[model samples]
Target chain A: MRAQFVLSEIWIGLRRNLTMTIAVIVTVAISLALFGSGLLINRQVDQMRGFWEGRIQVTIYLCNEVSANPQCQENGPPTEEQRAQIQTDLEAMPQVESVTYESAEEAWQHFSERFESNPALVDAADPEDLPESFRVALHNPQDFNQVASAFEGAPGVDNVYDERQILNRFFDLLSGLQNAAFIVALVQIVAAALLIGNTIRLSAYSRRRETGIMRLVGASNFYIQLPFLLEGAIAGLIGGIVGSIFIVAAKFLLLDGMQDYFQFATTLPISELIYVILLSIVLGVLLCSLASFISLRRYLRV
Target chain B: MVGSDTRHHNLREHAPVINFDNVTKRYPTQKRPALEDVSIQVEKGEFLFLVGPSGSGKSTFLRLVLKEERPNDGRIHVAGKDLARLSNWKVPHLRRRIGCVFQDFRLLPNKDVFENVAFALEVIGKPRRFIRKVVPEVVELVGLEGKADRMPDELSGGEQQRVAIARAFVNRPMILLADEPTGNIDPATSIGIMKVLDRINRTGTTVVMATHDAAIVDSMRKRVVELEEGKVVRDQSRGVYGQAY
Candidate 1:
């Protein structure tokens, strides 16, 4: 029954200071939602990496008679025995998942189809300009370095290269973006915390006499603090709901509808979006709780 | 001193709700002690008053009774317990036994007279049914029956003081300490507040009122302790307000 009185008083106090309570909720919601967005982007980047790395292939170009690159020292094409021997060596390696040898003509056709978007590059380059390559898919992408090292001085091998460097540059861009998001989230969270603290302090000050009278009337410390704490909590909850609605709207109207032009699918899904909303509520509670507690401690003698 | 060693023996079973013994209290920023070597005693059902001009330390004496401040030297007691040694943990419990009324009324602006009186019981965790019965009774005792739902600002100054007195006595506290219960009210309202307090005193509750109201003190002729510059100049039974008026 005593607990009920305390809870009821807290309810009344929050209702009395509805505006400041709403402010705290908005502060927590907006900051947490941004934090959640950064998290989602990081997760998407991880998914994309896992998807592409599984299909990545290691390529080894064979030396040709007309080639002048230092590693391709041979003046004539390799015999069928040499080709068979190379294929056997690659198949025997534990790291090599599969092997497919493409002749020079096949390599040229692949190049033409890949560069078909740029007619000038495809029309200007001859088929002979490209190399006859042996493509090897590895069970472990990390093990590509070991296989490339093994084929370093093999006969008919011009160069052994892994696609990891190209993938690294692409991943570097996404990683940088994720870092930028984290920095933005950090700065905004601090600002929100300070705002919450100040707002609650003002509210507590406005009702200073009330707090003192509560103490005189045998109100426990927790009882006196409950209303202010709830005030901030309600604010955080409201802010979270508002910010989450904005986030969902942004995902629908901006990220999803116009993503085809930019080809960036970093937008969070509806389920994940719901996860962000839940995150906002939790964030709102924690931030407002902290802010209100700190504010009450500083301002109210209780 | 009212000679009653037999009553003193009974006080051991039920503590004399307040005690002070050569208690001297000086504020941190003041040159003189706010209360100096003050010693007074009262039986469990006694009605008492502290009367003095402003700055005569009557307010300070009342504050000490409440343990809002501790004596810089000597001892102070309330409800048979040492107030000086009470930890922060015990302060609230000590407060629960005492009902205090301020000169300003200090009523909550948001609450109506019903809630105002009920608030005292509510803080002490009275059940809803008990509150529903006790609140109206106390409100009627203060003579504000029709004005139960009226806000503090809506009431006149005397009516607000009545509401405050109702709040103070609502819990049936062991002691009721009123600091200028009729300070802002007219003489008629002052008589009303005194009458209500007299009824509370009749109910075996100890009442200590601190005020400079000459007419009320002389008319009631209760025991009055008059102070001047932190010292008790006179202690009289059935005393008038005296020269300070």
Candidate 2:
């Protein structure tokens, strides 16, 4: 029954201050939208990260001259026995998945395919002079250092390169951008909370006389605080709804509609969109609830 | 209807509901005290009137008695709780023992008469079933049963005063403090409000009414305490308005 009274008072208060309520909703919506967008950017960065890691492989170049080094050297190409031993060692290792050995002729053919449009460059180069290379695959991409560690001083190897390091710098840049957005989102959320608090205070002031009369009529301070708290909560709920709308719109317009405009792409799962929307609602509820609590502390003191 | 007590009633041993001992109230912004060394007693079932002009601090006296403001100079006891020593949290409990009405009627303009009357009980965590049973009874007592669903604006001035009285008395407070309950109404309506106060006092509730109505005070011959410039000018057993007549 007491619950019914609180609910009834909240209902009347919401109906009474319709315009201010809408304003609060708009402020909360903008803040939560910024927060949700920040989260989405972070998730997108994570997805692109996994895609880049899967393709990062170590490239093993063979010697061009008849050097004694078994892996690679600038002076000479590897002997057939040395080449067979390297292939056997790579295949037998647990970390190694598969290694495709491209001979000098094959390497030249691969280069020709890349520059196929320019027939002049293809005819000018000698296929027999090109060095043989090993495109190495690994079971664990993060253990790329392990592959480099194993072949550091190998006999016939000229160089060992991992593509993953190049991709990491890009991830770092994206992470920095996401962090900035998060900080701004946090600031806006604090602003929204203060907005809610100020509005409640105004509401209290508008009816200051009535509050004094209620206090005179034996109404408890806790009882007086109930209506204002409910008013803040309802404002937050409306704000949450508006914020979720922005999140859904961003998902459709940016992620799907403009997919081809950007070079990198991702498939944002439906579950993730729903999670962001729910997160916006939770943030709205929590922020407004805190604002109402702080505002009531001073107002109810009198 | 005064109580059916032609027999000699012992007033002293009836347990005074409102007691003040040298209570003085000074506002923070004021250079002079609003109430000065005022000590008074009104027993349960006593009908008393506190009469004073504008600056005599009649409302401040009522506010002090209800624990709305603590006295700066001396001890004030209301319903057996000392105003100075009472915990801040228990202020509401102390207030519940006293009912108060205001000069402005101070009704929540949004709520209808029924909810307005129910508000007094609702704040104390009273059960809804009990509120339902009790609110209508007090509404009928104040002759506002027909206007239960009407908001404060929809009612006449006298009717609003009746609703305010109903709200004050619905909780069954032993001590009732009315601060010029009839100041805004006509003379005929003032008589009607006085009748309501008289009816409540006849039921063993101590009532203290602050007013400047000369005819009503002189005719009733009730106990009157008149104040001048924050000092009690006269405290009489059957006092009239301002000692003019």
Fnat per predicted structure, each in turn? 0.47, 0.60
**Global lDDT scores for all candidate models:** 0.79, 0.81
**Which candidate leads the pack in TM-score?**
1
RMSD of each: 4.7, 6.0
Best by DockQ: 1
- List residue ranges in candidate 2 displaced over 4 A: A2-5, A47-55, A60-160, A206-213, A252-270, A300-302, B1-15, B84-89, B108-115, B122-133, B144-156, B226-234, B243-245
What is the Å distance of residue A52 in model 1 from its true position? 3.1
TM per candidate: 0.83, 0.78
Question: Residue B69 in candidate 1 has what lDDT?
Answer: 84
Instruction: Looking at model 2, give its docking quality level.
Output: acceptable
Quote fnat for model 2.
0.60
Write candidate 1's Cα lDDT for B175-205 as tens digits: 8899988888899878888888898889888
lDDT per residue for candidate 1 within A19-109, as digits (tens), equals 6656555656667666665665566567667877888899987878656766566445567887788899999999889999999999889
lDDT of 2 by residue, A1-302 (tens): 38877787677666667777777888899888777877876787778877766666778777776434554444466678768877888888799888999888889888999999999988987776667878888888877788787775676676677877776776777677678767887888888888888888877777576667667666777788878887898889889989989878877775565345556656778898888889889879888988988987877664
